[model samples]
Target: MTPTKTIVQISSILEKLFEEHFEKKVEEMEALAVSGSDRRYYRISGGGSVAIGTYNANVAENNTFFYITELFRKHKVNVPEVYKINKDRRAYLQQDLGKTSLFDLVIKDGFTDKNRKLYHAAMAQLAKAQWIAGREADFKQCFASKQFDEKAIMSDLLYFKYYFADLQNIQYDRSLLISEMELLSKDLGRVQPQTLMYRDFQSRNIMVYEGKIYFIDYQGFMQGPPQYDIASLLWQARAQLPAAWKEDLLNGYISTLNELHVPRMDEIYFRRGYVQFVLVRLLQVLGAYGFRGLLQHKAHFINSIGPALKNLEIFLADHPQTPAYPELRSLLEKMSAPDMQDKYATTRGSEQSKLTIQVSSFSYKNGIPKSAGQHGGGYVFDCRGILNPGRYATYKHLTGNDEMVRQFLERETRMPDFMNHANALVAINVEDYMARGFEHLDIAFGCTGGQHRSVYAANQMAEYLRSRYNLEVTVSHLNEKKWVLPDAAKTEE
Candidate 1:
């Protein structure tokens, strides 16, 4: 693929920074995935160390991140350390916090005990950042807007209006909706700003490395009531945290804040602010997903729309008596109607009860297996890229599922990397499908012969999907005539 001009320019800066910082030549620079923002990230590995090289067209945002990182580090906030930045501030190098985002861990592990512990720790850290680090931050050095005041609040609400609701062409009294938004903004802005509100605080932006939680993408932080940050964390759409878990985390956050002794915050006051902010955050996120997914045609963001709309439904249903904004509430309810849901459905069978994921291993000679259900055409992965174990005499009789064959493939071939990439690809689709209530996915792996590489890859994928997603997964090996019991796919709802 041809590198874009901006990426090429950023790469040159990364090379220069690497040479100056480590006094060693750059060996490799690989562009990382694009994120929600315009910022581009590259992983630079050289001089026995790795760091992240980032480029963003928004120089003001870049300066805010640099300044906040420095200030927050002094205040003991857990953020990646900045190493070097370009003179123009278009690109910079920072510590690489590894690839395990909290979101990834949650999806892979499910809401496990250890994951909950990490979340509590994250909440504690968040409290400290909001209170201590927030108090010390230089407001003048803040990016774009220094505070999440009435204007900022209105911008987010209007973003939802123009980008999301308008794009959907939902019918509403526009003037009434605007008036309600004005009232809502005033109600939210009435609270005195006390802490640093991490505008985008959520699991995806939180990185877990070396058993520690670190913050990222926080340059958008602003001076606002801490409740905004709380809403951002607990009401995050994709996370889909249980209401009880949210309450526990919120209480823990409150306890941490009390320990800091910054100010006495009563539960009633805080809860009121928290609820309103949840509404605001959901609107902002829905607007973002609509613009990025529908407008820009990004698959990941498009996939996220269902979960976000679900969040909106839950919030709106819970608060039926919207005395502050009846028109706004009705508008949101109409936007999340069945017609709108169908418009954003990524695949057919998205209205089904439960999704069935069939994982099969087949030989190239025999051909790929067809999906069994109404929803046809799913993922077909070619696993022939790795070195073939079938070529070795010792492993000729062993299948990919055999313990010896599995170990051999893991050690000698690029099977682990290939499998990891495959897992990521399937995971993206599975998450979207699950959120949209899709049923049945057929994932098949093909190799030179189904007995070795393809069988092993298929078994791994089956186990991963079953454990990670708790979805109904059954493994079938076509060439070997080994098939899982038919009852294996009948999982409890």
Candidate 2:
């Protein structure tokens, strides 16, 4: 097919697919070529702003991408707004991400320190995306259709082996390699599972527009190793950042992880992240070189092989004690010998789960809390009475008589202080309370009479707590009999 004809065909397919879903017409279409695999990109101008359409039927279904994109947007990440999707046709319309990829920026000599700072900021945003998605159960539920467990990891490994090893005419004991891979898989499985792995997280797949990073080519997201994404960033194909910068970036990632409540994420996980980096890079290099380069004549993949190998060597030499070092080093050494060809197992059995366990502790004193506490636990601090308090008043005033009640009621009640104190107490007694948990906590507001002061205070306090703290709160008046009605004979309205 001619290039123009092919573009028309794909554009028609996309237009038809989205129109069927959203009942909209495509006003303008301009194609762009910067994506991997068989996907096609187009700028569809219509509906207020132009929408970018990504059509990749083979790698991912349309609806899946649409849903995932919406999820990312909902979690406050800057995902292109998904206008429409047709799962059957494998096409969708999204908000246009402008005409700039980080790849383009770097090529144009736009790699200023300011840009680098922006990139790190973008990385921080990526971290937030991971954090929110990782904690969600529904996010994990979405990947039920995909088998990304140990077997899948192994399958990817096998893909690498098939292309890289076979191309090099290498042969080794498959059973032994499989055995070692099985052990490696077990170790990996123990690392900690989190939702939302943007399977291809690299500079090329990120776009910089209006001083923010926009994520693209993210349909391969899954509930897998968190380190996978981090590894992808540190060992990206486009830029070879310095070790100190990488460390700083990794530290930024850790901070984001901590904010999101991922457990036990210390230096150990950092080391594990490096290991994951090597593994993923190895897989990508092998797969890209074998499938894209050898089979499809994609020169980019072929060119990447030397650099990939060099990187692998550097990583292996640096981390000699890693479990996969012996097998990898031996394989590399054999590959260097002209006559040696090695065949290795690419798949392995699922190992133990690797989720970080986080627990929070709060202290309580005399059924009230004195301070905020979280031993890796999530806590919400609410500041009440900071805003308008009159809106929360529950007791209406009497016009005449009952001056005492009016004075009492007119004085704003001060229960927020007590409630905060109560919350502090709850925090302190968290452990003890858990041992013998109480069903409810009722803090009463009382004055000279129940009518004015107590009721007003109770309302004010409730409003304050609700606005400020991340806790369930309720307000109630303990006394209300002091105030005389404006109309005694008739009931007070």
Top candidate (TM-score):
1
lDDT of candidate 1 over 337-439, digit per residue (tens): 7676555554433233388888888988877777786868588989889888777655665677666566557655788778777877887888788788787
Which residues of candidate 1, in runs, are more than 4 Å off? 1-5, 342-493
Question: What TM-scores do the predictions have?
Answer: 0.70, 0.59
- Evaluate candidate 2 by giving its C-alpha RMSD to the native, one decimal: 26.1
Model 1 has a clash total of 1
After TM-score superposition, what is the CA distance of residue 420 in candidate 2 from its true location, in Å? 72
In angstroms, give how far residue 192 of model 2 lies from its true place: 1.5
Query: What C-alpha lDDT do the candidate models reach, one value each?
Result: 0.79, 0.54
